[model samples]
Target: MTTKANFPVTAGSIVVPYGHVIGNEKWRGSEIAQRLQGKIRLIFEDGLGLVDFHLSNRTCILYISEADLVAGDEFKRRLVRFRNARSLGGIVIVERTQISDQYFLAVQKLVVLELGMVLLPVANQGEASQLITQLVREQSKDHNSNPFLRKQCSQLAEPSLFRTVQQIPGVGKTKALLLLQQFGSIHRLCNASVKELELVVGQTVAQQIYSFLCS
Candidate 1:
């Protein structure tokens, strides 16, 4: 349970999960249409579509009619708490839609099962579930498995670093992201001396960063 699970479990697969949305009245139609359009585009783009969503002003509104929401680093910023995200339109579409709490968890859980995290129940419901389970099990086995699958395996099919950066001193969300963008790797950035770090973060911050990392 502690090890992070991923999403999509596997390409071209899924189950009948529950879903709904809540949002502003003025923008509902536009938002719903946008969601549907995005689903269509994404399915064709990467064979993936909306899983679930909540209409709390806690997230940003993505418009497909005029504004582009795909690419340019698409992600659900988990660290930041968002609010006041009312959908702006004449129809009151989902200020938020297509992604719900359960769907997210389900996708991640399914990914974990795929990554050999745990053995779960047969979610197939009829012959489909049994067939899917068999296929997944046969595709991956604990012992004597293919080396490529283990070495190149990924959660939700997205690339991920095996180590956690949360415990790094002075490396909160913002700083961690800054380092990731600047240095492109944690080990390399951490290996920097105070003087070298100063070139990038200035004298005061460089010292603080070095001390925090070396600590």
Candidate 2:
């Protein structure tokens, strides 16, 4: 039997149930649903595996556990779906510590920077709601006037330096900004050394960044 349900309209918002629902007694399952009341047009979907919440702006927040993230080919395939989805501003992955190093590395190279998904490390699923809410708020604001949103919307249309630079191996949104400040351009940053990157970011992250550049 199909688990999918017709998108339900409540208080003028569309609530669609999309995935397999495994509920515990604690209401942890409906955390997004509760936190997002009256915020957007779409409802919190229970079935979406790649992203826990998809906003009206098409930005999605994915809350990943160790098991779901390390499913090898399956994981990569889901990421591909996120990449191909239309109207995507960006994707956010809320990470847990149980994720294996290999899976984390794959996500870093193939999913995050390449696909324009953001990586947010959270202590657990409980912390994802606030972050998701924050992203929704930011995205729902003025697109034309807000310089940040304007830039992000342009990024949604096509890859921009604001977004593309983050795809570099170990670089994230923050690190990407730092690299831009240090190197003044993506071209120069591409040739940056482990030592130079270390001075900007840190030793461990620099090593990872340099290794990814080399590969």
Candidate 3:
């Protein structure tokens, strides 16, 4: 019942082994833990404090039962404590049965909008187990496997480059085209000296371009 904001455990301090989930001892005999057995290795630990499950060093899960939702604002206060503790990236898994459905929106707003934590609704403990399996697998995979985390190969369009170059004072379509032709790219053009720019445009225009770019 002690929802202390100053819980000693922190996300950075906990080291979860690869491909394994460190679950709080409270979930040892629960349905979610039973279902997660074959899918991913689950290890139980005592005194996890505010966290229900540690998916990784940086991420953890806080589960809210139907009973918790029906009880009152205790879950909200617990979430607030967890958020204030700044322990980990808390992913809240809440029961969303017809009985608890009414409280979902309010819980979502507090968990996602106010506390800035991830909120996922499960119909029951069985569904919660499946979601936890997927999360554990995602955490175990190499970061490069994720498209968003992968290195992107970006190529700037010539039309966009031409338009950007023309934004410089005294630079029109003709001078922009000429500068691009001489320098090949905006990076090279920006590095070009006023003397170098004189070759593309006149001395006065070159000074203006140099000043516009440098300024």
What is the overall TM-score of model 3 with all chains considered together?
Answer: 0.63
By the TM-score metric, which is better: model 1 or model 2?
Answer: 2
lDDT of each: 0.31, 0.52, 0.73
RMSD of each: 17.7, 8.2, 16.4
Query: Which candidate order results from sorting by lDDT in descending order?
Result: 3, 2, 1
Best by TM-score: 3
Check candidate 2 and list the clashing pairs.
18-47, 19-47, 113-167
Candidate 2 per-residue lDDT, tens place, 12-63, comes to: 2333333222221123336554543444333333444445454443344455
Candidate 1 lDDT over 13-129, as tens digits, reads: 332112212222333234333434322211111222222222211211222211111222222221111112222111101111232322333323222222212112222123222
Q: Please count the clashing residue pairs in each candidate, in the order shown.
A: 16, 3, 0
Give each model a TM-score. 0.24, 0.55, 0.63
Ranking by TM-score: 3, 2, 1
lDDT of 3 by residue, 139-191 (tens): 65665564323122112123334544565679999987888778766557768
Task: Report the C-alpha displacement of residue 123, candidate 2, in angstroms.
Answer: 2.6
Model 2 regions more than 4 Å off: 1-28, 34-51, 85-87, 99-102, 140-176, 180-208
Which segments of candidate 1 are over 4 A away from where they belong?
A: 1-166
